[model samples]
Target: MSLHSMGLELVETVIYLTNTLICVILAVLVTDAWFRGDHKGSLLYWMIAAWVMFAADVLFASRPLLSPVVARILPTLLVTVGQAILLIGARVNSGQTKVTLVEPIGAVVLHAVLLTVFHFLAPESPLRRVSNGLIWATLAYLSYRGLRQSPPVFWRSYTAPAKAFMAHAIFHLVRTVLVLLPLSSTSEALNTFVAILGDLEVSFFMVALFVGLLLAHLKQRNEQLSSALAEVKTLSGLLPICAWCKKVRDDDGYWQQVDHYFRNHSKIRFSHGMCTDCADDFRKEAEKLQPSDL
Candidate 1:
């Protein structure tokens, strides 16, 4: 091979290796999160999506060893299905939607059918690329919508992931448009550049997404801990109670019934009832008062 050809090959190898490394790291991070009790349905879906993408990357990198039909269909199917699942995961994570198998399953089936039909009709044509890109863009838009619909407190946490999905969508849409344009030396170079840029973009986005999710979970946990601590502190200080009346002294130096004090200071509510000894004494007093019961 010429020096230029050799250099291009080396660059391609490096890019593929880097992509593989990032996907593996992301998979590990997500798996750890799930084990650490981030076991939401959305998280599970996201993990599956990551693995599917990883598999697609691996298959593509080994494409030279595979037959033509397998080479085209497998990777495309993996990517399309993975994107669909990722969208569902985002929606579920946002707490705005419940997890349903229908969407992800249907998405996978639809992509598979479209890819199969297109392969027969026009193998590796602009039409195929356009269809693939539109499918991905649609899924990305749905994921972005889910993030946008998140509650205010959580929306901040989703910002990075949302941006990542948006960037992916835009990139694919541009690629689709580029495919439709007449091919030239310049356009070919641009397409190659876009492909390289996509790899780098995906790597950065995965790391950012992992960090964002971890921070979001930590923030939520910290808030819960702080609230619990405040409750403990509220009930912990010296509670001065009258030796005889059972009334408690308030912070304002006023005595109030124990039940009233607790009700005001905390969430405790009281039900009026006499103890066994008090109930017996009340019965004796009632019998004494009923003198004319001959």
Candidate 2:
């Protein structure tokens, strides 16, 4: 390769490597959150997507050592699959437990088809360089649709992930379309700027998605904890008590006196009052005990 081409390749590789490292770190953090929260569903799927994305970047940067077809197909395939999986998780986040895989699978097929056709028909075309954007945009649109339909979370940002994803998709689609124009095709400087902007945009998109996922799960967990607390406030049946000591055994196995337990656990308050039988017994004893006898 010429020196200029070599330098460009080096820059791209460096960017990919940095992105890969970021992806790995984010994946680890997500996995840790998954375990800490005992989370499943979308969080698990998003974690898997993070690893897949980093793997895609690895394959993309290692293109120099890969076979021609393997280099092209594998990286693209992984990208498609990773995004599709992310969409699946997004749907789950929206409470669509039975979300169909049809859209995601169709997107993968479209990505493969687009890449294959462009590789054969116009391998060196500038438009082909950004053509994968079409498939990504499709997935993004699907994700936006899924997430926008989600019930509004009280403390969470509404459709933030949906918007971040859609923004990237729009950027890519617009760039791809612009490349088809004669002015865009001929302007080397503009193309270079687009490439740099694309990298930055991708980084931002990744970070936003990660943050969105984290916030979404945290909101869910907080809501769950709030519900539990509400339930606790409403004291229920079956308190374990020592009959003689009148101490209640809490779930933590700590013993608390009747008045203390009620005060701590419920809205009920203590009153120094005796029952009818106890009052009657006290009166009888009082009458039997004469002040003169003392």
**Candidate 1 lDDT, tens digit per residue, 209-270?**
55555565666678878988888888997999999999999989999999988888777899
- What's the TM-score of every candidate structure? 0.75, 0.74
Task: Note each model's CA RMSD in angstroms.
Answer: 4.5, 11.2
Reference-based lDDT, each prediction? 0.74, 0.79
Task: Give the candidate number with the greatest TM-score.
Answer: 1
Clashing pairs in 2: none
Best by lDDT: 2
What is the number of residue pairs that collide in model 1? 0
lDDT of candidate model 1 versus the reference = 0.74
Q: After TM-score superposition, what is the CA distance of residue 263 in candidate 1 from its true location, in Å?
A: 7.3
